[model samples]
Target: MELIEKHEEILERRAELLEQMESRREQLKIQRTKQVEKSEAARHRNITLLQDLQKIEDRLRGRQLPRPHLLALETRYWASVEQSVPAWEHFLLGKGPHPTDGPGQPPRRTKQTPSTAKGSGLPPRPKPRTAR
Candidate 1:
């Protein structure tokens, strides 16, 4: 009779442990679902904000305004170019290379013909013998 009671106690403990494990598993599932929903909401909010910013930028571009200082600066730049036009033409027509092609680039090397051929007069190298 005592043995039967001990076995029943162990079986009851096992059933309680299984029930607790199942409950914990369900709670974890619920937490994961909540996290996913929050992430999706954040993504949607970011997209909406970016769209609103783009709209504001488009409106600003459509109604462009000219400032007086910028116009003055442009006029001065063009006037200086016009004043120096004759000097620029003289430099371009000069015999030296253009200033734009500065000495920064390396000079190209030319390929030489084989020295042993025909009128080169150099001795030819011997060919290596192959083993059988």
Candidate 2:
């Protein structure tokens, strides 16, 4: 009889242990889900900040306002700039690299203004890279 009683007590203890373990496992799963949700929210916030920065840069370029740096502009154009205008032409306009060119080779680099103004301002044009 005593032996049977001891076995019954051991079985009850084992059942209690398994119940506790199952409860802990469920709690862990809930915590993991919360962590994943937090990470996704952070990523979304970062993307929104990047988009705002791009809009601010556009405003700084002065696309909405008239600018002295703007040469012949039809709808804020860059055709003259896009095509190969002579380096002297930029010099005549009082904006460009110093006239430096090899007799046979093209100029090594073109000149451009570095503007600090922002808020709808156009970005500075790229300087042409000529042969060394």
Top candidate on lDDT is 1
lDDT of each residue in 1-132, candidate 1, tens digit only: 999999999999999999999999999999999999999999999999999999999998898566889989999999998987775575456533443454886533223467526455556768898998
TM-score, predicted candidate 2 vs. hidden true structure: 0.43
- Tally clashes: model 2: 12
Candidate 2: regions farther than 4 A off: 62-66, 69-132
lDDT by residue for model 2 (13-129), tens: 999999999999999999999999999999999999999999999889856665656643653466645554586677667575545555776645433345433333666567899
Q: Tell me how many clashing residue pairs each candidate has.
A: 0, 12
TM-score of each: 0.44, 0.43
lDDT of 2: 0.73
